[model samples]
Target: MTLFRAFFTLSRAAQRQLAFGAILACLAALANFGLLFLSGWLLAGAACAGLAGLAAQQAFNMVLPATGVRFFAMMRILARYGERLVTHDGALRIIGQLRVACYGRIAPQAPAILHAQRGGDLLARFVTDTDTAGQYYTDVLIPFIRACVCGIFFIAITAIFSFHCAITLAVALLLCIVIAGAIKARCATLSDRLSATQSRIQSELADTITAIGESLSLGASFHQQSVIMQCQAELSATKRHLAALENGASSLIAFCATLTALCILFFAVKDFQAHLLTLPEVPMLVLGGLAAFDVMSPLPTAQKTLAQVHRAFDRLEDACFSNTTAKSTSNDKAFSDYSSLQFENICFRYSGQEQDIFHHATLCVKQGERVAITGPSGCGKSSLISMLFGFYPLQSGRILLGGSDVHTRTPEDLAQVISVAGQDFHLFNGTVRDNLLFANPASTEEDMVAALHTVQLTDFLATAPNGLDSFVGDEGLQLSGGQAKRLSIAQALLRKTPWIILDEPTEGLDATTEQHLLEQLIAARPDATLLCMTHRAAVLPFMTRVLRIQDDAFCPSEEKKP
Candidate 1:
């Protein structure tokens, strides 16, 4: 089966729940039909009996019809209530399946794809798209199926009273269904076109919001605001168009339904006048005929929802299976400890860039060496770190860590040995211990505390009432910049990898603290190979070597005496 088709059968639990809910819906609908038809029959029979005579009224038995009406009324209410609960729960289960499936499909492609799109765009696929697909089961798929089953049963029940009447109802139902199907096809086409624009608008808005600080700082906030307003206007205009189309479709269906009911009533009344239909049975047939048409009431909404579901599915497919992600190279070889890391004849550039960032570049750090990489802004300091971790595919040459080529290594294997603390270190809205635990989940409290001490955060931990349990707030904003940086370092320390790459490690600290933090990092892993990408020339004394970013070549720096 194709990937999308496989999604339907991925979770048996959801399927079973959906089936159970559908059964309840069918029962509820049938019960409603029974209530309306029987109530009409009872009322008509009593009126006729009373007009006949006192003796005829006494002979009429109202007990069975009255009890049946009450039974069906109660059953209808209870069954409908249960059906809603079951269907929604089942829809939630389907959402769970989509969440997991999408995660699995997008994970491997994240690094490459994430850089190309805004976070909000991806969030829509993961959050909003799943919601739409789940509604497919509850609002569209389930209702459409229920309508079919009820329609068939309704016609069969009517056939018992009169074959000609049943056929008339069947023809009306079939015609209405064809109309619904046509609306659905058109809706799906429109939705597909709209979904792409919606995703783009969502991405643009998210990107703008995320970069609001930068935009304000650069004095470009007005431009960004104007762009956002434009997008919103376009979206609103598109929505109005969709509403107009839906309104037109609804009116057409309503017209068809009213015409069908009147025609059926006319035929029934004529048959009754001819004595072919009994007086008491005539009301039941008319009511049943109307109830049978109720089966088509959900058709318009079902068609529209199905169109929405298809739109969501298409967007999710684009997000997960997009061609933007570069092909990955996988290796199963175990990473062995090495005294040095080698970047040999490396040539690299960002995707779609004409110029190479690193052309025949080479770098080597000996075992247990402390090397500080100093470069001008936008000199690819962080890019080097990202490439080392296999976040970006190698354009040419190879990086050898512990004698094994990194390009040939699986990301899992690479991760086991190389640990990095990036410039924009993410602290993942969590507690002090929780963030640390992310680095080495198997580590105990003792290991965690020791790692924290290695980064010189022990005193801060002792001062807090929560200590290791201290809440860091969102993005560790509760802590000072230096403290957050130290916490990230501590998390990396918890990993205990031989190679530790720190991108701007001592950023956001005073002169004295910067030196102190550098000392602590050097002391934290005395035997581990440490590489620092920073602009702090004052911290060079602490490093075995300093390399400066230059115009022509990346060569050894003239260490400035602090």
Candidate 2:
């Protein structure tokens, strides 16, 4: 879709407010013109009458002209205030909606499709790009509309005095608009480059902050800082260039407005010399024409902003809605019964890697069976689990759950069927209660307390200042590594799905703690099937069958580890 069409679609919900804001802007512009035009006419007519003597002065009604000047002045002030209030409010609403819409479009395709994208780049699109798009409405749309609306009115009024003056003003306004468009086109590439530079800076800063401890310890801090500084310098340079262009455009626009005013004055004076105008008409025409040109002065800056808006929309579109693969046709409904998982001659490889992680590998886990897959570190064990849960696509072959392709089910349906507790589980920067409720919203406080007790987090919560209400800092930084892993297991247990997949669930815990955690998990949901991937022998005793991954294929272990 075109950038303008996409922007309009996103802003549709606030159409009424935006339209009303535009009307208010036009009213304000016209009121300002009236204030200046009437004041000039009133002053000139009063001076002319006074010079004609006492009878002319008495005949000239100063009361009506004076009242009109006051009226226009009040209208200008009130309309200006109303215009700013309405337009800004509407623009903020659009920005909020744009962020939400972008998130909604990109969320379902996350990690699976967005695995190649940097977190900082995506953050820039969500925050910075959305804000830039919102500026289009306030800085470009409303100003352009106001200028056009007031321009026609100004010409019509001028024509009432001298058609030649009106023609001069109209042609000058059109020339200014054309020049503004040309300047905007010229700045398009710079605008695009500026946006990319800002994203790069955001990305570099985000990466540095995330790994500050590692960088400092490894003595790579200087290198990382240098890289970020370089990005910042590039960003600053691009912004400087853009500023120069905008300033130049503004100066040219101002000069054009001045020239247009002079032309209109010259036409008015010529008409006066020809007896086609009076002294009062001459100043009224000149002042009114200048006021109208003043309304068009913002057009150049507004046009420059349009270039930035275009680039913003382009980045937003690429991040949120581009290159998305459609889900395969299959049953959208969640499985109603406990079903077996089957991998049929599957072939898989990671992106940008030549080696196959799995080559025609096949495996099955029968319903209600406790199965464990064992492998060394970096053996694609986690990748296998991710594939089974539909996180990655297979190069060849199929993964079926309950006799249906896993790809056929929506994330919602798949979520209902399987729950995973992995080493990389994320925790929100919220109260413990909030994170717990995320797994199963229907779980009660008592249920949460019981689950926490099962995972041996009861002691930690007891020591917390507010029990379940205590804040678990960003990504659960408040908790130890072992505590976070236990919390992840507790969340998985809370899900109560038909299938549970655990990745390195017992890697960091002590033997006693692991044993207790496993016992409680088995007792809590005895009917649920467990599929665990672990490197430790401690988890083998709980499994009915232990399969070892070797040569990219699963083989039944000769004997279960004691």
Candidate 3:
């Protein structure tokens, strides 16, 4: 979708709040102009009256106009505060909604679509870039709206004193706007480049931090530091260039506003000489012109901000919605309770690869059956699991679950029916309960304990200071490899799905521990279908049927249990 359309859709939720905020901003601008104009007019009149002696001083009433000055001053302050509060709140609300929507879009296109992207780059785009996009509403859009509305109002007020002055002010404001637009156009390419550089810097920093230990061991920490410093220097140089352009724009805009005020003063003096304008009206008109420029002063900054916002939206759009293979499937479709899985005539290959991982591969697993799939390293075992989860699109194949196409099921539906515990599983840096609840939010303490017991983590849970609430350090770094893997298994088991897929489930465990885990894992999910991909023979006897990949297709293995 176009950026405009995307922005519109994402901002619809906060439109009411933003619209109200815009109105308040306009009010604030008008009040500020009123304060300046009334103060100038009132002070000029008072000075003139005092110079004209007692009679004129008596004729000039300062009480009402002074009161008007105080009123406008107060109004300006309150309105400005209200405007900021409402607009920022609305902007924050829109940003929060956008983040959620962005995550929802990107979540489905896992390893395949996101493999090339660095974690930090993706994070910067999702969080930082998306937040920058929100500034378009508050910084660019609102300011532009206030400038236009208040600009017209100021010009109308000026026309009451001198038509020439009003026309001059209008032309100057229009010129400033035109110049700001030019700046925006010029900054577009620069902003895009800056955004890319920033993302790269984040990626580099993240990689360095994540591998700090390895870098230190290899005596390469200084190299990574140098690289980061180089990126930082490039970023600083780009920002400096952008700032120069912004500062130049602001200087030119201020010059135009000052020149416009002088021209208005010249017109006002001529009208005063012609008796068309009074002395008090001269200062009022000149100061009013300056106040009007205040409304437009933010235009240059807004225009410059627009360039960055555009880049942010473009990055968010690409990261969130691009290259997704999700299909429009009916969520209402009924999924059978005792469904069989069928992979028929499957053909698959990764992008930029010469060989097919699977070619005309067919496999069938009946309900409640234990199926084992074995293949050499670098074969398609893990890829097959990814396919089952719709993480990658098949070149030519259909995976059926319960007589329905696997592709036809929603992500939520698929998650409800199948759970996979793979090697190299990630555990979030949160409490153990938090991780388990993430898999199944409805799971209770009893359910979690049972799953933990099945994975042979009962002893650790008992010894953990906070039991289920015990924190798992980053990626479960606090736990041993076996404990981490078992915890992940417990998390998967908490899903209580009809089918569970295990990929090298016991790869790092000893034979005795692996055997015990396999036994308990099967016993815990007695009626659930099990699909395991393994190189180890210890798990083979538990499988009702065994299949091996030969020439890119599954064949009945000779080791299958009779």
Candidate 4:
């Protein structure tokens, strides 16, 4: 019943569509039962009539019974085909809605979610989770309902021949249903384990491929290959366990079905001898009992699917119903006018670590200042910048941008005041023009060309094929290191916000290129506040003021003025 709740979360239209598919499925099951019973009834009746005499066969009038046989057969075929068509369409629709819902839920949690999971794992959730969540309703729920409908109808029709015989068939069918339910519950854990393991293996394989170029460059290719192989072996072991359980349950269902059919046949023979049922109808009861059991075949598989559906819903619910769904009540006030950037009594640390990366830190960068922050590696310089931009919750203090509390302003509002070009900004698999357009979709070609010129890439673009329309491959793999870093700078400059935060933006560039680009950024955006975090000191002479991070606080640089 908990799994069934996942269905109602869809829109009413989708629920109705799925219900229609189930109705068609039930009709198809009944048709199958009707076709089997009528065929046995017709053939046995014909053989008995012919044995008696050719004239008796002529009197029986075979046309009506033969027509009944054909009717049920055609109905079964049509209904089954319609069921498949409608159910698949409904399933596809549900998958699309779920994809939208999942993305909507996870967007707020962003890099926070990525911090808890590998990017490949999130990618797998986007793709695989949506596909499996619908299977619980279509393959399992619909089929189970169809079997119940067919079971009841078969028993009711059998009662017309003899009340006592119907009671016997009903008991046998209920027993099989109970046993299958037990098997399904027993194997449920195995199904859940298999689903989880399968997803991990898929994510691991994807991560392996994405990082292959890096691993080979680091001369750690064999280490990466070993990790992938271990994951594959564990996945294989889980699959084998699942396959064995399913096979065993299927075998149990077959045994119970055979035993039930034999019991029904025995009762039918006894009824015939007692003169309570006709001799011609005996084969109909025997074959009809076997046909009744056919409807129960999906029961075992349905139980296995129930387990898998539970796992998928758990993952989806974790993503969609996460705590991040809480809406921010912060004001949407933008900081257009600037006086200074200030951090007062700032304290910060990662979520599960005790030591604060920065405790009681304070600094001020006056408006329209070009400041560079330099520090040793892993000294929380980037983390401090992240807090300044409102990327995460502050530990115990406030960050004021243009005198507004960073926590009190929304991210969209902050975007108007600040733009960041990080060391690891992504370039999607798209055209150079498309990537640039992401910063501002309404930007004209003239604005784009000007941004490229500021970053000193205009000459390179003039000689390149496809120019702005050239594909960047995945993560801009086709570009050289310097080209990728310069493109990122070009994107940040296009924002033209009141504040620009550059984290190691010129790392891959030569000294002349770095100095030229930094000088251009300062000249063009003389009114904008620039905060650059860099390891290299080549671009420092162009900065208006330089600060060095030491002992958990920002202060004037110890080095000589550039």
Candidate 5:
């Protein structure tokens, strides 16, 4: 989506809050301009009475007495305060919703889609861009609405008094709006470039932070620091240049407005001197014309704010909605009685590669079968599993679960019947219980302990300060690689799904730990179908069948029988 359309969509979602803010801003603007008109009238009346020596009688004849003026001033104060409060609160609320929406859109995307994106860039979008988008409501929408309302009202009132002043104010206001639009149009390309660079710098910083330890170990800290400094300098320069451009545009508009107001004052004074306009109308005309300019002084700043919000919208749109190429099917198919998963004549390859990773690879595992798939590195074993789990699309084949095509089933349906634990397991910063029971919120303490016990993690839990409630730190840094793998296994076992896929589950574990894990898997659910990919021959005895990838094809090895 274009940046403008994305911003409009985000604003449209908060239309009710925006409308309320707009109404309050309009009321505030009216009160503000009304005070100017009333003050001018009071001054004019006092001058006429002072010249005639009837000040008290003229004050009583005035539409707004001293008390009424005080009350109007207080009303204007309250309206301005309310407008600020409402606009800020509304902007915050919309930004909060947009963050959630952006996360929700990305949650279901395939691993390939996520792997292609930089983690740092995603973080930037969530933090800076979302915050910037909120300016649309607070800075641009409310102020622009108030200015337009006040300008139109002031023009109408002036026209009732003199068409010449009204015409001048109208033309000036139109010119101000047109000039603001031109400034925005010119800055659009620059704004987009700034946003992209911002995202890139943020992403790079995140990566640098994440790998700081490695960088220090490799003596690359100076290199990383130099890169960060360069990025910061570039960011500062771009911001300063943009600010200067916007300031220049605003100054030009303000100058034009000042000149126009002065011209109107000159005309009003000439007419009054010739007796064509009454004495009481002189101050009213000047102040009314000045009020029109006051209402429009901030229009250029509002336009600049809109440009920032538009850039933010562009970043958010690219992150959230632009990568739909990996969207899976949305059909609902029952997985309750899944007896087997079958890969029928499956042929697949990575994008831009000529050789097929899996050519007409056929495989099937019936209910309760413990199947082991072993092969050398780069034999498409992991790719085969990815295709089975609906992470990769088959080039020319069908994957069936319970006699139905996997692609025809919704992701939720497929997940219900299958569970996988790959080599790269992720653990969030939370209690150990949180990581173990992530898939099952309703799991009781007893269930958590049982899963841990089944995975041979009972002893490790006994030595911990808080047992299962111990904090694992970020990405389970508190645990060793083997401990993390065992935790992942416990999590998968907690689901107790019919089909379990474990890819290199014991890669980082000691021999004893690996052997213990294999024993536990055999004892936990012998009836559940198991598909494990590993190069360790120690796990072979537990498998009921062996499938090997040979010459880019999956075939039964003669070492095992079906």
Candidate 6:
């Protein structure tokens, strides 16, 4: 989409605030130009009356009319304040909307798609792209509109005084716009390079930060630091080149505008000397033309802002349309139940890879049945579970729930039926209850306590003073590893879906705790289907069947029932 269309697609609140901000900015520019013209007229009128040897009273009367000029100045100040207020308000609102849109679009994307994208790269897009899009409305679009309005008004006023001056101003304005456009065209290549470099730098920075401990342990801190400096230096060089381009363009435009103003002044003076215009009229006309030139001074700066806008637009375009898989499909239903799951000849491969992760993988789980899957690392165990949980698309197979294909179901419909607790659990910084009831907002305190109890967390909660209301630090940092894992399982249990897929559910727990937690889980949801990935053989007796992922194929173990 074009920049303006994208801008208008922002939330209505932001659009309305931006519209008000633009109006205020235009009014401010008008008042500023009006004040300048009035001041000039007052000076010329007073000079003529004073040179004619009028009395003090006459001089005072001549200059008294300029009092209205002060009023315009005040109005200009107020308009400027209003413009700033509205602009910032609009900017912040747009920032929020852009962030929401970016994340919302990325959330439902297939895991294969997300896996192909680097975490650091995605973070940069989320933070930097949203920031740039916000500038499109605040600094570029609104100002451009205001400038056009003010430029036209100033030219009209100048026309009444001297048509030559008006024509000269118009030509200068047009040249500035044309040059700005050319600069924008030229900067396109550089802007894209800069944006890519920025993404790389952000990715490197995130990696460095996340691996700081590793670097230290490996005695490679110096090497990582050098790499970080290299990225920083590259970014600095890119920005320097951008700055130079802007400065050069600004200088050339300023020269052209100055030459145009000088030409207007020369013609006006010559016309007056030849008695082609009255003396009072010459000063009035020259002053008005000069005032118009003053109004054009900010045009070059606006051009620079426009260039930034172009850069921002390109980033936004990438965010909105780069990977089709990132777009979220419509969700018209809510998650409520999970009764059964079936996978038939399901196939999938990682992007840019030749080998398929899952080759004709097939499985079925009846209601209340508990199945355990065992596989070597990287044998598509997690990938298979992700597909089962609607986190990835099958390459050439069908996933069904209650005899219906899952692809035909909305996200909410899938959500209502299946819940998953993956190995890499994420917890928001909030109270324990907040993390537990994340899926169901209407879950009561009783429900929260029950879930905690099922996860064997009631003993810990009772001693924590705050119980379910206890604050878990960022990502549940304050909680022990076992506690964090149990919390994630508790969240899934709280959803109360018909199917629960747990990946490494007993990881990081003691042998006793693992067994106890597994028993509690089995007891808590006697009617729910369970797909658990585990390596511990002790839990095998509790499972109804075992599926082994061997040689990239899912095969049932040969433990036959009598």
Highest lDDT against the true fold, candidate: 3
Ranking, lDDT, top scorer first:
3, 2, 1, 5, 4, 6
| Model 1 segments more than 4 A misplaced | 1-3, 189-230, 323-340, 362-367, 403-410, 442-449, 458-470, 545-562
- Give candidate 4 misplaced runs (Cα > 4 Å): 1-7, 214-227, 318-341, 364-367, 408-410, 558-562
lDDT of 1 by residue, 1-562 (tens): 2435846776466777778899999999899899888988999999999999999999999999999999999999999999999999888877888889888778767576667777887998899998888797778877788888999998899888777778888888888788778777677776776676777778877888778789999999899878778877777877676676767766776777677667767777787888777788777877877777666777777888788887788878877787453455676556655767999878878888888888888888888888888888888888887777667766787888867777666566777887888887889887888999999999999998888777678888999879989989888879998899988988888898888888887788788777667777777678888888988777778878789866524788876733
Which stretches of candidate 6 lie above 4 Å from their native place? 2-4, 11-20, 55-60, 274-284, 324-339, 463-466, 559-562
For model 6 the local lDDT of residue 6 reads 54
The Cα local distance difference test for each model comes to: 0.80, 0.85, 0.87, 0.78, 0.79, 0.74
Q: Which residues of candidate 5, in runs, are more than 4 Å off?
A: 1-14, 54-63, 324-327, 558-562
Model 5 Cα RMSD, 1 decimal: 2.6
Q: Candidate 6 deviates by what RMSD?
A: 3.0
- Between prediction 1 and prediction 6, the one with superior lDDT is 1
lDDT of 5 by residue, 87-162 (tens): 8887888788777777877665656467788999878888888888878777887767877787889889888877
Candidate number with greatest TM-score: 3
Q: Per-residue lDDT of 133-174 in model 3, one digit per residue for the tens?
A: 889899999989998999999989888779999999999989
Task: List pairs with backbone clashes in candidate 4.
Answer: none
lDDT of 2 at 246: 80
Ten consecutive residues with minimal summed lDDT in candidate 2?
323-332
The digit string of per-residue lDDT tens for model 4 on 483-523 reads: 88888888888888878888887888887888888878777
TM for every model, in the order presented, reads 0.89, 0.96, 0.96, 0.90, 0.93, 0.90
lDDT at 254, model 6: 68
Question: What is the clash tally of candidate 3?
Answer: 0
lDDT per residue as tens, model 6, 1-562: 5544656688475667778888998888888777766776677667777787747436456535577788889999999999999898888887887778767666666464566666788887778777876776666776568767877987887777677777887888777677666667556666677778888878877887878899899999899888778878887987787778777767777687668767777766777777765555565555555555444555545555666556666665555455534223445755333466778887887667798888887777788888988877787767765665556656788887777777676566677777888887899999998887786788998988888888889888999868888998988988998899899998998898888888888888888887788788888899888888877676677789888887667788754321
State the TM-score for model 4. 0.90
lDDT of 1 at 73: 95
Worst 10 residues of 1 by lDDT: 323-332
Give stretches of model 3 more than 4 Å off. 1-3, 324-330, 559-562
